[model samples]
Target: MKLSRATGTIATLALAVGLTAACGNGGADAGPAAPVSMDEEITLTFAWWGNDDRAARYEKAIDAFEEKYPNITVQTQFQSWDDYWTARSTEAAGSALPDVVQMDAGYVRQYGATGQLAELDGQVGVNLDTDGVDETALASGQIEGRTYAVPVSLNTQSIIYNATLLEELGMEPPADGYTWDDLVQWFADVAEAGAEHDPQVYPVGDMTGNNPWFLQWLVQQGKAPFTDDGQIAFTEEDVQAWADLWAPLRESQAFFPAKRAAQLEPKTGLNSAEVVAEANWDTLMPNYTAELGSDDLELMPIPTGDDGKKMYWHSGVMLSASASSAHPDAAAAFIDFMTNDPQVGEIFGTSKGVPATDAQKDAMTIEEGSPDARLLAYEDARADDVTEPAPVPVEGYGEIEVEMARLSEEMQYGNLDEDQFASQWFAYVQDTVKAE
Candidate 1:
């Protein structure tokens, strides 16, 4: 979290191949080694993206690790999310990636396909310990046929709301089985009540242009954003239907206007309690609670369709070893410590989202009334409702997300209507996916 900008030249791809030979003894073909010798000295570079709070927690966890394994030392590096990726990309290109790298689902496939990450399964020094972890959650980090990463924690999407504001408005919070119509009505009710207190206050933030939200909506309708083969899956009519659902809210000011919405950050508006509700990842509950300076934050199941809940648990993020790591064995040991160690889980809490392993989850001592407890309870109550997650997005999926945001903003600002937005988005997806 002590973020510093790093600028360096990209390493040549040939350098990557050379580094792999020097560092990759823990590859799939290598036989497992005995427990690390106490006298053996090894050092690893661990990198991740987080804020000051998380960095502090990790620092403590690292100290504990070093105390336990006095022969192994870890050097830590961190940056803001955007800067972390920029640095990682440069390092990856130059065959200078950290021994352990923090990876996101969005980039996992891209990196894995490019041979930038180590194949985790059957690796000599790695103990992924999938026995107590949800198989689907663990599988989230696999790409093609190789296990490239291990989930650090699990998360699911939910409707996070300002519980205090809803209570102040004399409204009961939404229930678990809330439908899409129920959500729309709730938004309207909040917008109507909010006008009396602050004319500019809206029921929700500007999320009309968000790809994840749209993707969830599509999933609820029994459609997918992209097919298993990585082509656009939803029809043009499906996109229009989604747009039409929000058109009325935009017109009635139930949501933030385009100009104002674009300016709002995650720590403002809905996240900060200025809006009554927003759709976001459940892992963000603590951040919202901290930002609002109150424990009055609550999460509800996302609105469902006739088929029931389409929500599925996913890896919030993952820890992956670099194929070019000079100390692959040490890197794998560090990953195992992070994922399977109960003490580490206690230190991390829900900072990275809920621990993925059952033992680590049970070991976590979240205060009874805390946001972390509430999230776990929410997840437990809806465990039976989870469905198969959509496929891990393919390469070039980022471009589709950008196009969606742009067209959504166009529709919101009246430059394009629902039909036009849908047509354009469909055409773009068709061209992009087909070309791939």
Candidate 2:
């Protein structure tokens, strides 16, 4: 709702819309006329996806952004995850993207490469400071050498396990140097323990789990998804190596069966019946625990290789500017004000992972005692994984991930022998990566 200029300067409460955006020439086609300077009054439409909780929180964060900066007003849009991407990609294609939208790291290459985003290199934000934010995570927005967005949060990779399950099994957690063989044995032991007690909960993985699903495995050493260039990195052997970890699990009854594993692979949300533990990014651990209806989940380092090298991949959620934005500097400034600012961090809390800055972590209401506040465990788990470099080709990026999955699936289901899969995976990856 538009507010009278007389009601000017009031705090903009997130949900309450404490004040209207300071737009001028309201009937103009542009919605809000561009201002001459950062101090000039303007209103921008900002969109994002989330459920009721995220919607409410984002509204408040927007309110906080507006209230703190009188000259700038932000109108907010919220939706579920599916709708969020649909609206973003569709509208962006039509030149109708909201002035500022939340950009996930995975899509940085996709959208940023299409010139649908703005460059965020060196931009400042309230809650985010590029310093403590893992450079690897922050770098997810870089395509070639140009930066397209800023990762507002610093989430890393690791495996999330069931602490209670460990306790029940009379087992200690996987130590830092544990290998695939160690995990195989561990799962067998857990399964036996579960049978001794409750007949239902298996020591093996729950049938429907996804994520922590694909990432850092022994196969990782065979070949990467993409190589030195922006092309595909693995051969069939690489694929088999990825599958090898789960292969034993399936054979020894340590993980879900073939059909069950397939059902759990593409999950965007976490819940029970998925798996007792799923290897995934460290940033997601807290959220997974919160979603699982219990705090039994805990963080564990990714298993190491015989050489003692542990591997993991890092992806950043970043903010990018639309190459088409006329107010590029101001857009850059807005990126700076929001993500780099501590107050903005307070408003965001762990909603996006850990705040991008240490100051925000200090001011956060998510106390150390809270399950959601367990940042230290995440910090420790990520201490060892080798962070892969981040870059992407101009197109065909989507195919790489899909092919990676396909090759992995073949290995998991025995369509390809481990040796053959590794050979093919490495060959394909070397070819694709070198081409890119």
Candidate 3:
């Protein structure tokens, strides 16, 4: 239902392709009972990144929103994953931005901390219902102890398997009881099956592939990815364990090559999918209907470790507004409507993962219900498991992908042994974090 977008890569290149528009304000005033939107007849702009699936759904909702608010006209612009952010940020710095915009979890903090972002606290977000949203997701967008943006949803990462592929391979999908050895056995089976069909899948996550998989492996073994207070969480043995995990996985030909992966268009990684399974956001399922057709795909939680540990990535965006926006109140209103309003989640559909609100999450349609159920179950299953932010106060916040890209490429090619790869990774962490 989601693409394995290692958080690092997804954040960096995701903003490259340009789909943002010259933005305008909606007439929504926070000053008095006169909501700016109700007082004036005007054109409002909104921006986001997604495929046609998202465009179609969002535009439809916009049309509906306008029909009810005849005085307010909405100008909507969407982009492929690459260009969405650049356009928004550029517009923000330039003082020309949409009234409502899509914001990311990490960017919200950095932007809010720097004063480039707005607070959705005025008339715009005054009516938001924060009940039942995951605190962790909310925290990511909060900076300096102030809320910047509201989350659209909580998207947990999981291994989506091709039911048909497993059936043909004479194998059943991995379940909660399976441990590392069980996964290795499955990999072996995939190798045997690869002789005839596509083997297991990897999202070919960018800089994210650089650490978390191994970190998750460590977590499975009762270790942490980072320290309790933002320091290195494990030792060389942890690195060795990681090397043991992914290097062999690459050696066994368990994943895809970087070339084949790099050529994939952003927001389109899952389009060419043929392998058995890959990591992705839960929200994309309903939105990317064209890619993942009805009943052809099934979602499953990532397998547990031998120690019964599971980990997740909260791949949701923590939205914040531009501090310079003249209509901060109006922007805040839209934020509340988007995250708290059930229809907005239904409109966005899995574009940014599952809705963060309980009311909206509970109102999922039958088609949306099954996958949402799987997502909630996965969240519950790994509620205690650890998860780390892929990006932090590092220097090369954008280049972590390049580092990961190199390692992932080498691993896929089997150019280095597992231990060698891990050693290389640990060294990279050392050199990279220091530089950051």
Give the winner by TM-score. Answer: 1
Candidate 3 Cα errors over 4 Å, as ranges: 1-45, 63-74, 92-99, 120-125, 193-240, 254-274, 283-294, 305-313, 368-398, 414-436
lDDT of 3 at 137: 63
Give model 3 RMSD, 1 decimal. 7.9
What lDDT score belongs to each candidate, Candidate 1 first?
Answer: 0.74, 0.56, 0.55
User: Which lDDT tens digits does candidate 2 get at residues 1-436?
Assistant: 3332211111222212212212211111223323225466565656665677866666666666666666766656666766677666666555545556677766676677666775554343422235656566565667766677776766655667777766765777767678767877776776666656553345444221122334345234543444333444434544554556555565655554456655665542234534456656666776766667787877776666575354533543456555545444455556666666677777777776776657666667776656665655566455556555443332444445555556656655767755665566556555554464
Error of 1 at 396 (Å): 3.3
Q: Please give each candidate's TM-score.
A: 0.87, 0.75, 0.71
Model 3 worst lDDT window (10 residues)? 1-10
Each prediction's Cα RMSD? 4.2, 7.2, 7.9
Clashing residue pairs in candidate 1 are 11-94
Question: lDDT by residue for model 3 over 144-164, one digit each (tens)?
Answer: 446666777676555566566
Task: Supply the global lDDT for candidate 3.
Answer: 0.55
Off by over 4 Å in 1: 1-39, 124-126, 198-200, 228-231, 262-266, 430-436
> For this target, which candidate reaches the highest lDDT against the unseen true structure?
1
> Candidate 1, residues 261-350: lDDT per residue as tens digits?
557653567765578887888888888888788888898888764675787777887899877665566677778888888888888888
